[model samples]
Target: MSTEQPMAMRQIVVSSAEDIRVERVPWPDAPGEHEVLVRSRLVGICGSDTHACAGKHPFIALPYRPGHEVVGVVGAVGPGVSDLAEGDRVVLEPNLVCGKCRQCRDGRYNICRELAVFGCQSVGAMADAFVIPRDRLHRVPDGVSDELAALVEPLATPVHAVRRAGVGPGSRVAVLGAGPIGLLCLVAARAAGAEVVVVTDVLKNKLERAQRLGADAALDAAAPDLVDQARRALGGGADEGADVVLDCVSGQSSMTQAIELVDKGGTVMVVGIAAGPTTIPLHLVQDREIAVIGSLMYVHDDVRRAIELLAGGAVAAEDLVTATFPLERAAEAFAASIAPDQLKVLVSVAGPG
Candidate 1:
């Protein structure tokens, strides 16, 4: 008789606010049709993950596995999967959508009616190994390092927002909030050829970092005249605001500022997730003809462009990733990510393949 034990792996689960622990779980079964088994290498802690841990995120529930931004190596491929093979480095898109939905059929699967994120709503890639559909994996370029690959997921969101806002050569842009997403928006806007980009944040350190990352102006969000400051910095008068205002904070104050800071007929892209319902200036929106667009997660083309930006040196990973911890210390990593000074915190899952 032959006997063998099933493989086990460590997975991080957040049960409630400030409650996170690692549990040993059985390894995922072999990939079925069009599936691929991926061995996670690095995972980035997202702001939503922290919000869920703090019981603030409206979408993500408690007691969920927490790794959506992941870079991994393919371990095995199932039948019908031809493009990717074992040992290929890939990044997770994490969006699980229903193909029959209107949005999906229209090629906007990021907001599918039945959209469920892998880490937020289902089992995530925080484990040593995970099985996901082949279509959800984007092969990382050879020149991209593991750290840079891990950033593709986060960067994709900003890229999507910038594209939707129609940022282009000689465009004037203002980003509200200098966190990871905000800084990324700055980078994406600049890459899209924005003539001037102004970034705002309550944290002085974050503002300084933004200036170093090519922002034309980094203003203090708490300044009483922040609106005027941002407008002036964008080379516009008080009446002529920025061409596009990206509200990366998505709070009441930031959203209001976004509406006021955008030029007439310009766009106000809500790139961040609001913790709760907040009121906006509906009257101003109507009179100015401002398009208050809500940008959700990104589509596949956005991911491809994000990868290109990272691989082409448009987005520098070293400037963003501030701290890293081993998988065993994932809780510590989550803690570090919430630190006011930290930009991006990563958990080291497995070594580079």
Candidate 2:
């Protein structure tokens, strides 16, 4: 017999708040029925993962392995799996929903009663090997690099949010916060044939990036005449406003700005996660007939569309990968993720071995 040993799986486990360590763990065995074993290639660190690492997330407890935005290659498949085989590159749809729930039955699995995110709810994809249900894996099309594939999950969020707002051809959209999600929204909106795509942010660099990403107008959030500038950009004067306003920040101030910038009957899509509860102008929403919609994490369809968008060159996902770290430097990756200048931080996991 040849003298060769199998590679051990290295897992980046978060034992407690602000404590992340990479340890060599036993390699996972064969997948169960309807499950697939994935060799993680790249895992993006999300804001929620940071919050969980800091022990600030209400739902995520300590000792969590925080990794939801994951890209990997299939290594093994269970007997029940048919669509995917070994060597196929895929992106993990992190949301795990109970099929028997009412929300799942109604096709809104994002809000299933027993919904749990991959990294936040259970084990995350920060390991060299991950075994998950086959249905949660979406194939990455050809020509999409590993770095771009890592961003499919983040891009999927904005795709779902923009679609929820009914953004289509000729629609005017104003995105509050030129963060990753906001920038991706600009891409999605432009792909959807939006007439005017305006973005607002406090950071000039982010706004500049937004402009580079095809934003029609980039306005400073602290400017004295931001409202006037937004109105002029949308060609809505003072009375009319953008057809859709996306609150990618989701903080109190961003929500207020979203409500004020949208037209009377326009839709305000909330895509960001707020730290705590904040008061809203309920009277303004009711009187103006404004539809304030909340968009959670994406579904499987959004993941597929995001992959297609990245593959088709609709959005340059590589532009958001500002920093990268190896699996051994996962702590540094988490630290860099909170930096304002950093758009997306990815942890390089195991290769396609």
Candidate 3:
């Protein structure tokens, strides 16, 4: 007769503002039907995670697990799962949706009426091992590295936003914010044939990073003549502005600047989650006929496109992921994520795949 100990995994949770705790929970049981057990390799700390950690995420309540951006290796596949097997690398889509919702039925499920994110609204992939439905996992291409795979979730948002704004050949684009999402937006827009891309941020280091990522121009958001500088970089007349302005910051000031820097009949894709009610220029929006669109999470097509872009080297992950921490130091990872100097902070779970 032999006695063995059950396996346990470390799960990170945010109980309150600036409070992150790691709890040891029993390893998940063998996945049920249509589910796959995944061992996390890399998990990213996104803006939403930072906001949630600070108790400012309007939609996400506190005491939630904190990992949505994930790259994992399949440990086991439940019955009825055929496409995936142990050792397969995958990226999590993270959006939990209700199939009966109007948006879901209409094929726009990213905005399901009762949409709940995996990490925000439920148990997330911050654990060393987790079981998830097969539908939520996308296989990573053979050539894609773990770093790039970890970035798919974040990149998908900008892909959806760019598609929503219809950025195409010769279009002039100005992205407000040099964060991960904004830099990814620049990459997506340029790949979609945007003639020129200008990025703005308050931090000099972020602006410099954006330039390195191929921004035609990087400007100081605090500059009094920011609008003028953007217009000049966009190669237009004094009165003209960019064809599309993506407000990745989505703060009151950035919202106002987005409207001010978009050409008449253009679109403003709000990619960032606002902390609270933000007032934009209604009269200007009405008079200029600018379409202010709010972009939420992405659909699977966006995820597929993000994979292709990352795999093809269109979206470089080298500079975007500035810092990485082990699972034991998730608290420090969250702190670094909110740091003004960092772009994307990752928590190494199972480490390299």
Candidate 4:
């Protein structure tokens, strides 16, 4: 066995109900069997982390490290691990799927019955070190910025959503919300060759950022004529409304609005999580035959392709990076992610480890 390192570091912690703490944690051990120990470098905060902290997330189990969208370096590999070794710079793909599930057998492992996301279901990268299955990692290319590498996980999500929405050249799309995920959805939709992509948000600052990020039009959701403006921007009536609508805001209002404004037969992709059930107008669905697709986390190929997009400069991952905090100051970082006017916040556990 290799000798263990000392000087254990702080682990950003979440106990329950908006409580955020940091505690000294031991360096992770070498992998066991098919696992590898990653010295985590950059772990970005997701909306789910905030919700999880507030006890609003349904999937969370407390006293957990809460960052799943992670990037790191391979420090040790366990027995049976091959093709990768120590010192490899990598980013993690967090989905752990049950190979025997129906969805897995059909190759749609994204929907596996026993699917488990890294931060949500296991020890996460918010800590200084963590062990994960070796296969969960993907190598980050040489030119890709650490900021971009950190976003590959979330980027893949919106990419997967847009793909399922069937967006491509000339598609008219609307992305609801201007938060991190919504903004990423806009970038992905635009990259998909959409002729026009509009983004909506209640905050003007976020809307302005969305405009700067290449949204063809940014609308204020609180406007009295919000729907009218969106429809008019798409060219004038319901028939001219967006060919696809991505609902990045999980509230009922935004959800219903996405369904209401798309053209007949258009697709509506929900990229956000709903706190509770909200009824969609069955009449609108029956009339338009709109395809409502609920996108979960990204699949394997989605993560790979997202990395390709980042490495090739197609996706503006770094633009999405707003703040970086040392792992010791992780509580402050998580609090900042909840504040307005920020995009992506990252906790740095290990420096390019």
Candidates' lDDT values, in order? 0.91, 0.86, 0.91, 0.83
lDDT of 2 by residue, 184-259 (tens): 9999888778999999999988999999998989999988778778989998777889899988888898888888
After superposing all C-alphas onto the true structure, candidate 1 shows an RMSD in angstroms of 2.6
lDDT of 2 at 125: 87
| TM-score to true structure, per model | 0.97, 0.95, 0.96, 0.94
How large is the C-alpha RMSD of every model relative to the true structure?
2.6, 2.2, 2.5, 2.2
**Would you list the clashing residue pairs of candidate 3?**
none
Candidate 3 Cα misplacement greater than 4 A, ranges: 1-5, 351-353
Supply every candidate's count of residue pairs whose N, Cα or C atoms clash at under 3 angstroms: 0, 0, 0, 0
lDDT of 1 by residue, 122-168 (tens): 98988788999999999999989999999999999999999999999
Candidate 4's residue-wise lDDT over 175-227, tens digit each? Answer: 99999899889878877888888899999889998888888789999887887
Candidate 3 residue 84 Cα shift, in angstroms, is: 0.5
How well does model 2 score by local distance difference test?
A: 0.86
- Screening candidate 1 with a backbone cut-off below 3 angstroms (N, C-alpha, C), the clashing residue pairs are none
Give candidate 1 regions above 4 Å deviation.
1-6, 351-353
Candidate 4 residue-wise lDDT at 242: 88
lDDT of 3 at 47: 91
lDDT preference between candidates 2 and 4, better one: 2
